[model samples]
Target chain A: MNERLTYESLIAAKLEQLAPLPALADDIWARISADLDREMPTDESEAPSGGGPSLPGTGGMLWPGLGALLLAVAGLLYWYSQRSGIPVPAPSPQSVPADARPASSLPADTGSPKGIYQQPAAVARPVEAMPVPLADSAAAPSTGKLPPPVLPLPDDSRPQPAASASQEPPPGQPPATAGDKASPPPAIDTPIKKKPRGVTGISNNDYRIVPDKKDSARKKN
Target chain B: MNTPDEDIQLIIDGCIANSRKAQELLYRQFYGFAMTVAMRYSRDEMDAADILSHAFVKVFKSIQQYDAARGSFHAWLKRIVVNEGLDHIKARNRFDSPAELDQAEEVPVDHTVVEQMSAGDILQLVQKLPPATHAVFVMYAVEGYNHREIAERLNISEGTSKWHLSEARKTLQQLLQSHR
Candidate 1:
């Protein structure tokens, strides 16, 4: 009879008789509850219980450095796009040719004095500027390379009678072809003007700009 | 003393309400059972305590997801605690077993031998088995998991799970015979 003890029945019997547990340290729950208070409210769900789909937004544990890497990449893209766009230089008012004036650039609609494209004398005279891209020799402003073909401006931006607005490249017109004619060749001999000292006078005591320790050290190096 | 059902319900409600007193009561009631389970998975008592603490914290935090309709709360908690222990062993890379068990003869033992043993006395015998073999036996035989579930938990092939179970039974039979 003593030889009949199988492994399965023995395990079952032993597990049935519960073992005594030692008392936990007094400070255990106190530390656990304190840690829970800080970390639980924000993440009531992501406690890593078995057999469920994992939840998101554990910035430290789940993703580790992923959130920081994503933020850095986004910041770089924003800075690059903003920094790449240089402002188009406005042509001088006096230097513009009379033919370049927007009023004469497109053929005026003769059908109605009140034609939709007709701008009121006090309001938008360049209402007719919509159907046709404003075409004039000197009216369009050019920056650095043929600036990206200016999209047709909304009627709200009334054409300046003195300065020609930049024209959009016509269909079948590659930007490079139109750009070569419009772009003024660089004047290499043109003297570079030194930017004048701050136009507004300021006392040195107005503010202190302290360099960060690392930046200052790099500068000295 | 509260009836078992009433006590479980009260503890569930208390934990959901975030009452520290209720959590303490709940821990006191279940801690022994958890320790017994944890000790078998771990190498020693200190490691078992660490695993139990982590499992209990998870139990309290995830109490809201538990539905009594699914099964008894004790069964549900045991599953979580067992998985927690499995994960701890897996994290330390201690769960590997050889692909095959050499075919060994099964020793005959009297079923009455189990009636003579206390739970602590049996745990001592189990602790003597190699860690890998002990884990497989406890998971398959004691915990009532099938070979596939044990395979998944232990990160071994289904065949390997079966082989470990075989090795564990053989080793236990020999140990049991020696003690007799």
Candidate 2:
């Protein structure tokens, strides 16, 4: 019992040691407690009922505008398709005309303007006939001797040489005088020796060709 | 006696029903005691008042869970208020210096000296303690809790609670001694 008394005394001492807190203003308590009496709904089902009608009123106005926007997009797509000229359904080969088929499918010569084979044959015959006529014209000119096809006249507008001067030698040496013509100067008969294969005669060999051995010996002296 | 109990019961019931009048009465009746507990754990008068008001709101909201058989309504409410004050200190991340505990054993605190000090002066000294130590000290000394009860309330070890209390006592002794 004394221990319990001591304990109580200790508690009293501690409480005495503590400062009393300042009183809270009544307004603060009133605000806090006032919040407590306000209910918070636990689920949507318990949520206040009036909030949904306002939303659909705004939502209803949006639908027709969205539909008009969709129709405008579709119209734009159609106009684009027309402008680009894309065939909606492609034309098949079977739809083409028979006359448009190529000529290779016809009989070998039947569909050509003349016969298909005859056209090239006819064209080649004309080319062959053309060269024959050209050869005939050339032969006719030679055989007929047509005055050498009228020799063209020389257009000699410049001066001409005197006819007598063609026979005269040029004026540098004694004109082949009659005295030097005796026996035609022994024919000078210098036998030109044929050069041996691959060997050319030098200028000294010209003197060795003199027929008079005496003249050659005097030349050496 | 029955009238007071019935009156308290009516207020509790009215609070559960979300009645504003009963909530206001409840707040008024307990505000002083709760704020006193709050001031022991708070740094200043305004902080004590703020904590007390918040605790009353929690009490009114959770009044449906209050069991009269376990304790007096006021004591339960006071516990809620004390816990709210401790939470405020925690939320603010207030901590006392660990050096306060280094001289824990040697620091001399005479209970008689504490007894002689006015309640206001003691509360001021308590608020000067680091938050953890002040909280343990208020729970153990002022609120009449054992180390274990303080540990449970503060979610700390019993050893931690004792350490805080000892540290708190040392600091308080130093403060009070200096005042001498």
For every candidate structure, what is the RMSD over all alpha carbons to the true structure, in angstroms?
23.8, 40.0
Please give the C-alpha DockQ score of model 1.
0.16
Q: Highest DockQ, which number?
A: 1
lDDT of 2 by residue, A1-221 (tens): 00112322454466544545333457666558445535422233233344644444554567788899999998897765444332222112222112221221122233334222321222122121222222123323334321111111122232222321133334442222111211111111223334466446646565476565576467553
Interface RMSD of each: 5.8, 6.6
Model 1: per-residue lDDT, tens digit, A1-221? 11112557667667657564575534445555655555563333345444666565663565657777899999997665444432333333333322333322222333433325542222222222223233343445553122122212223344432233345434443331112223422222323344556645775655687655766467553
TM-score of each: 0.48, 0.48
lDDT of 2 at A92: 21
Q: After superposition, how far is residue B162 of candidate 1 from its true place, in Å?
A: 1.5
